[model samples]
Target: MPEAVIRTAPSPTALLASLDPLLRQWLPRRRWFAGKGRPITGLTPVAVTELPSPAPDSDGAPGALTGLYHLLVRVHQPPAPGSPERPGDCYQLVIGVREVPPTRPAPGLIGHVTRGPLAGHVVYDALDDPRPAGVLLEAVRCGARVGPLRFDRDPGHEIRTGLVPRRMTAEQSNSSVVYGDRLVLKVLRRIGPGTHPDLELPLALARAGCARVPAPVGWMTAELSGDSWLLGVLQPYVQGAVDGWELALRELSKGEDFAAEARALGRATAEVHTALARALPTVTLGHRAMARIADGMSGRLAEAVRTVPALLPYAPGLRSAFTALGDLAGQGRTWTAQRVHGDLHLGQCLRSPDGEWSLIDFEGEPDRPPEERRMPQPAVRDVAGMLRSFDYAARSADTPVPGWAETCRAAYCSGYARVAGHDPRTDPVLLRAFETDKAVYEVVYESRHRPDWLPVPLAAVRRLAAPGPARLMP
Candidate 1:
């Protein structure tokens, strides 16, 4: 963590301006900070909405704040050494002001104010304070509008406010506060414009009567300066549930079969896809789209080979996969495309005590542009991502299980075929190409971030890019 940049200001606007340089100095240092290791050109304030300070608690306790502010700040970064420049991303910030310094350091403290209305006061992240966090829930429950922000509650579900909140730690991109075990509210740290798939897909599935997802009970949004931003969302948190990644590792530790669980998860995935197809727009992928996708994959592969010299040996084999995709497009074949969990992996799923698999985190790939995430794509992309995860888990374990990942892979495809009316295995050409492309991506990612884990994906690269055709199962 970086040291907080303290500043003194006479008023709110001045406080923001004084704190701007400090925020820019601190942002790239935090783990949840997305633009880490990059130089932040500037921080642009898009909107700032003030919230009513809460009154005393029922037990007559003082509220955390006499003032609350919700901010939308756009973070700008310059282009990579050789890449083109891109647009900045918006982030949500909630700050609280108090007359006295906190007994303990606040979660997101940026230091104290030294002058004016907030003189002799301390300022910290409002969501880190229980009282102001409650205000967010209150607004959601009553469907109220505070300044430019609007909160909405699903009429079918009731709200439970005033629960103590504890911010979850060690997160990568967002901050989530678990409100007493009743609801887990995820405050999106990197605020993007328009509706996120995390909100849109679940609501659509819930309305289409799909039980494979935990629907939001309440949601919060913002319409400021002619742009809309998704702020926070509330969902019923299933207690005693373990995420699929942890569960898979646990079973692997015991040398137990995970094929059955994998099958069920595959069915759940197909069900969600079916529901999404029914609820949202579906398009027939055109030749131009296929060409573009093929070209993109080829470009990524070229870039990966340049970065990881180990990929040089497999370049020929990798080129064939993209070439095959182009061949498919040239044949005038027609394919259907629809919304998919753009970043599906074992960590993105939850397994309940009752043995049901619920897919969570519909927010697509955070690295990609939001506009691209909303576009329709082949559902096989998700299947490919999951396959890579299954392999990664087995390889990452202390005791690597032979034949285990392959068995689960086949069983999962079998289950998917049962519901989707078409086996992903049947489309060998597309499936192989997608799997190869995904493995190449993993190799690049692991090489850059976790050098020790590079061998895990490199193993797949060697196999998929071998002389024989890419094969997932018997």
Candidate 2:
């Protein structure tokens, strides 16, 4: 056990209670925090453990002070009227306590601690401190089991130590730190007692000999009361790689064709889907199952319309898409359901300079429950998400590129058909419903987070709801 884990001076419960006020104010503001717009009524500590310090200095001397702690706090928020009662969400936090502020200003500073175990300390998100980030990677490299936290690495890979850490800034639902171009560690902000798809899917794909996704190099987990919760994952960092979203926007700016790149991405997606089907148990969703899924989509649309009145005009058309899905089920249609990248988009993909594409971030819609995200679903759901992403990129340009999205969409489907032996366009009903569902989600997300971006998805909503036969391209 590390020295930090052995200390017992600060009671975890007491520490959490004292920091309640600061946490309530800080948690909601975080991009990763899910309970935005809802006022936090309270925070109950579920589990807390001290973390190890950074490695020794260059001369092998002692390291900095041990002020980092791993915390899982359940946040309680007042529910909306008629909403089902449920336990509050649990968020994983890495906090650092310093006697004084860092030499340079840092993010996530929650002001000085006026009370608590260390009354005179300054508290901030520990990940912003390189020392704590290095400690996490070191623990993973050594496969350390400290207190309730377990750090493990794949036996096939050896992680090098002393890599400098720089936090990634573009992430919205999780905090990722890149370690000197070798590895990137993604610390999941919201945690629950289940195997997160972010770690599980990658490992499974690696086992199935799939190279379209990065293999996990190391991971972290927490054990509390005989249950395991996934905390973080470390994977190889694709150096000199640009994400698909950025690539799309750049190409659009120069009036360049992105069909070839989109086609390759589709092939990559198909490969991942094939591997997932082989690695995990798959099922055939029959009439009842498909109907239930359609009902859920309709229910979500109803809720979204209520939340964003702007969706009202397209409600009837959107409902027709879902209705077509249910009608298919009524006609005894069945589709294969397997574990998929629950939420897929261009942003979740990385394109190397060599033009090879690799998929990342399988955590799914952060707002959805963990178990729901882990459930089996039609692979077309991912295909639909990518399609919406194409439209979004095209519309996001200063001057919307006409036919750019359509050309890319056709090329992508053709590429997928080459690998999977079937094009997603062949299932127009399922594709339209899933794409509509994705647009509805985007509408709600933009309405709440970025009103300026609302028109992008709204454009898709109008096209998707246009009265006509379901087609491959809008």
Candidate 3:
């Protein structure tokens, strides 16, 4: 148990002023930081709360030297020319303060604070420290409230305290800590108003009796300006489960066929989509809505070509795919739209030791705005993302494996059709357009981040953009 101490919330003005210089240098370097390539002009404090720390030392001395704080700060960056001015992006931060730096170097050491109430204290990311991480879980277990911050847990769930914390390193857009292999806590780095799908979707699926997703056991939030901002969520950890991406690559390297696993994954995805539809609102898109969606795809392609000259050659073929969808809509075609995984790929799935597949990370594309990510879309959109993932896995191999990706793609669609009551392949144009759009997104992302890896997605682009009767199905 932590020490019971009464600490007042730090003054917003002094807190932001003291941390401004350190954050300007530290925030962009984080893997979860979304404002890369942009200079931060300033930071404004949204809320601040003092956090609990470890109990007194063994010698009956006070542990006043250690401090923890939860804060929400809005990062200001210059928008593009002629763009309307709006509030900058807000981020959730857990900061730790100590009178002295650690004996051994640790990750997330921000630096020594030179001003404000915390002057001369060494501050680091609290998530990187075990004491602070354990405090967060304890708060959830007790539903502790600190000023504007709220930590609540589902009363039906039992969360054991004093569990060891180990931060997950593979996450790119969020920070996660696993507690004694029992629960995993995902801390949202970027925050916005309204209900976040990461929490909302999983809870909805749980209520609908969906077993394919881990239900939330606890969560943290902040009430600000009449809106609740999700700070983090806690879910049961699947012990000894391997992510689908790593499993796929291992199978590909051994020349083993992955049709069975792919089929199971497809089934799992369909189950999630069905549960979401049953538990949430569903809408049928008319001709105009379809045209607007198609236009967005076309617009993204145009932007990609402008950013990556390598995409220029395939621009015409890709444009045709989007144009086909628009033409179909122009003829009054319509389709059902329901809540989905938003972004579905091999990396977003986990396979248990017993071979059960489970979907994770419903946050969708982290780069997209929250509202856009939460929008209902055709379920085939997720199917296209997974198909592209199969191709990616095959291409990542040491040598090209002929028909490997095709077999997995076909088997996946077959499995989905069995549960969905309709074949995704039945609408070749919609699937093709979605797949093309996903490939184009990959091209842009890889070109900017990993030049050598650009060829993998570009190969898909060549095949997807091939001039033909529109390669409908795998």
Candidate 4:
């Protein structure tokens, strides 16, 4: 275990005041705040954990607090159907507040506080809290045995670890605080128990020497006896890089040739699939897995179609696509199921300064079960994901032109086929099936999560539905 950093003296009153207006205003505006857009009658602070100040000034004031000040806040709200009545409904907010001089030099702190629970909070960028950041890094470098983490709902599994924290830009499910640019510690807002795929699979892959992904460093778990909640994971952060999506978009926007880049990305992705197949145990692609995949897509697609009625007409076509793909199971096309990066879109890949592509985030889709994510399936699933991403890059352009998708797709498929040893010409049916399946999934995803972005996937679906050569490039 790493050496424990002594916690700073409690300054609850000052800290509370510092959090006053900001806490009140920020909650309602946040997407994960449970009570988003709803009126919070009151906020009661249930717990506070203080840590030693990172750097203390002459008068004993903390230059910054290094440890995390985890506050369990109870937010009062009206009861909704199926909503929990007890304090269980309250959200746990782990805020890393650092006491910096009113005038500190940091690039991220330039913006003033906006609205919500943090409306009036004199909050600066928490990354300014080097004390906490350092403590987190040390924990990652040298494993630490900290207190057992308990989930409010179930208290059977006891999770204890000293993992470092690194600050990251906002993501879909949680706010990530990275550690040493090596690992990302994601604190989940919408909590649940049962091993999280993000933590489980990435660790498995890294241990297996899958070069495409960031290695897992540590994890924070919440025990509930029979099941455990994966509160956070620490994985190496790929520095000096841009996600593949942004890179592709830039290439398209500037009218630059992306064939070479796309081909390289394809090769990397194929290598990942090959590694995954070799490392993990095989499973027959039977009706159960196929049904699960199909059912999952159906549920999400149905919900999305409801949210955007404009997508109603496409839902039937999308369902048919999934159904056709699902029927391919048990045809001797099964491959070993090892842990895979559930979501493999261009946005999930990063291009290092050296121009090498590195995959990040092992947590399959945010909504799927860990077992499902860990299950082995066709390697082409990942191929489809990247292909869809290529389409997205073209569609997301300010002024998309013809032929870009074809150019990139051809290059990517060519590269992947070379490494995976799959000839598109011979496997035309299988390749087209994968692409169609991905397009269907994207249509529903974009419609619900990003309405304005629906056209990207919708356009892809329309193209696939229209029928052309299976392989875009010769």
Residue-wise C-alpha lDDT for candidate 1, range 192-244, written one tens digit per residue: 77878889888999999999999999888998677777888899988888988
Of 3 and 4, which scores higher on lDDT?
Answer: 3
TM-score quality measure for candidate 1: 0.88
Q: State which candidate has the highest lDDT.
A: 2
Best by TM-score: 2
- What TM-score do all the candidates reach, one by one? 0.88, 0.94, 0.93, 0.73
lDDT: the better of candidates 1 and 3: 3
Candidate 3: worst 10 consecutive residues by lDDT? 56-65
Instruction: Give the per-residue lDDT of model 4 (tens digit) for 35-84.
Output: 54346666665444443334443356543433345554567666432233
Give each model's whole-structure lDDT: 0.79, 0.86, 0.86, 0.60
Which stretches of model 1 miss by more than 4 angstroms?
1-13, 55-66, 98-106, 112-122, 303-316, 443-455, 469-474
**Candidate 1: which pairs clash?**
none
Evaluation by lDDT, superior candidate among 2 and 4: 2
What local lDDT score does residue 241 receive in model 2, on the 0 to 100 scale? Answer: 98
Q: Give one clash count per candidate, in the order shown.
A: 0, 0, 0, 38
The runs of at least 3 residues in candidate 2 whose Cα sits more than 4 Å from the true structure, single-residue gaps closed, are 1-9, 55-66, 80-82, 469-473
What is the lDDT for 230 in model 2? 92
Candidate order by TM-score, highest to lowest? 2, 3, 1, 4
